[model samples]
Target: MENELTLKRFVDIRRNLGYTQVEFAKVLDIRNTTADIERGRTKLSGKVVAELLKQFKINPLWLFGESEMQYLEPSKTSVIPKVVTVDSSDNENMVLVNAKAAAGYPQNIQDTSWYKQLPAFDLPLPEFRNATYRGFQVEGDSMLPNLKPGEWVLAKAVEDIAHVSPNKIYVIVLEDAVLVKKIEKAPNSNNVTLISLNDSYPPYRIEPQQIQEIWQVNSKITFGVDATTEKGLLRQLQESMEELKNQFNHGKS
Candidate 1:
């Protein structure tokens, strides 16, 4: 089932955007019938959502209640970031890990030359220079909707794995593949489970010993989106709407 956009959320968005009901609807191409919904005559539709996001590059998470930030920065407005840089010691370089190299990261974690050969770019964020950061191009949908493929994610290196928090996402560097998954304590004391956001894929356990390196998922950097990105945005909206409807029904009863 897909998520839905709710009437309350619609009003919130209108107010947040500093637009009257009609004015917000105007931009969403729903100006005509928008009043109907406002007067308890109709409901917000997917078409309006499609137009809203495409026109304003609004973050679906915020619009649908998944995130508080509605307007994503231009660089990360889309599902993918064009470039990622890792801040180096002495505050000079941001390591850029391309997909090709990221696929082989586990094997090269201990290789000094390989790390140096990784591309470097300058990042202006002052906080980035404070500690080591690695940028990885997400290559799979295991962490879908929230973390999409082609998007860039930054994580700070955890010097000691003991401090890992439950249910937090982390980059697990394994020998053959590098994974971005949520961490949970496995049944086996010696192993840990790596969970995927997309429930279609089952959770699996892994021995921490197999992990060559781990980084906590910090921030996501997005570039831009296309026509197809609407599918994701709509899905998020639908899910939020479903929750809202359930709450309303529960209250009425």
Candidate 2:
């Protein structure tokens, strides 16, 4: 009976919120077919159940038919959690401003302008918590099995650079571009080194004074959607290689 309730209510709740099976699967990070779940053909794993509760705030009791709605209304004894939702389209319009780059990096490419606006959607935004904002496009396979290429991450902003700790990921805005790296302070200088989660890419150091600003990524609010497919991977690779060759030629000239 409890299992039945979990299956039935899970489908009902997601549909009520206007999410298609594919959209809901993406949100849950599940790589399964939605039809399997909806038709009760597949059993929900504890991990999947946990993800549903965490991502959507679905009530377990309610999902199991011990309660009324998919979510409980806040009451004297019930604690209401905050949720932040971000839409991809709104972020697409955000503006990127100018900043300095490293020396001998090419003057013409150093000072360029671009704009990106993030898509708008409603998610939980907790009040009284500090938020950091930085932009980065996923690059390598280190964070793979989680983040993929061409996916964008919007991180929360942190006020104190000195407060950064080890093993935590951060979205850093340097003089030239925004990056996602694990931050560690340099022993001798006021600079911090950005280490890639993937070991393949070597870490790079940048002076604290050189950075215009830094933003802590909001993992809960930060989500990635597919922008490229396997079929396009080769074309993307060719274009990237060509661009690198051009840059190399320009530097030698």
Q: Which candidate number would show the highest TM-score if scored against the true structure?
A: 1
Model 2: per-residue Cα lDDT at residue 183:
87
Q: Give the TM-score of candidate 1.
A: 0.51
Model 1 residue 63 lDDT score = 62
Off by over 4 Å in 1: 1-89, 186-188, 224-253
For 1-253, candidate 1 gives per-residue lDDT tens digits of 1234445666666777788766766777775546666555675466766666777767666666777667654443121112333444545555656577887766666666777766554554555566566767788788998998887777777654555777678877776888888888745375678889999989998766666667788877664453134355334334543555576678779
Q: List lDDT for all candidates, in order.
A: 0.65, 0.52
* Stretches of model 2 off by over 4 angstroms after superposition: 1-123, 127-137, 140-142, 220-253
What would the TM-scores of all predictions be?
Answer: 0.51, 0.38
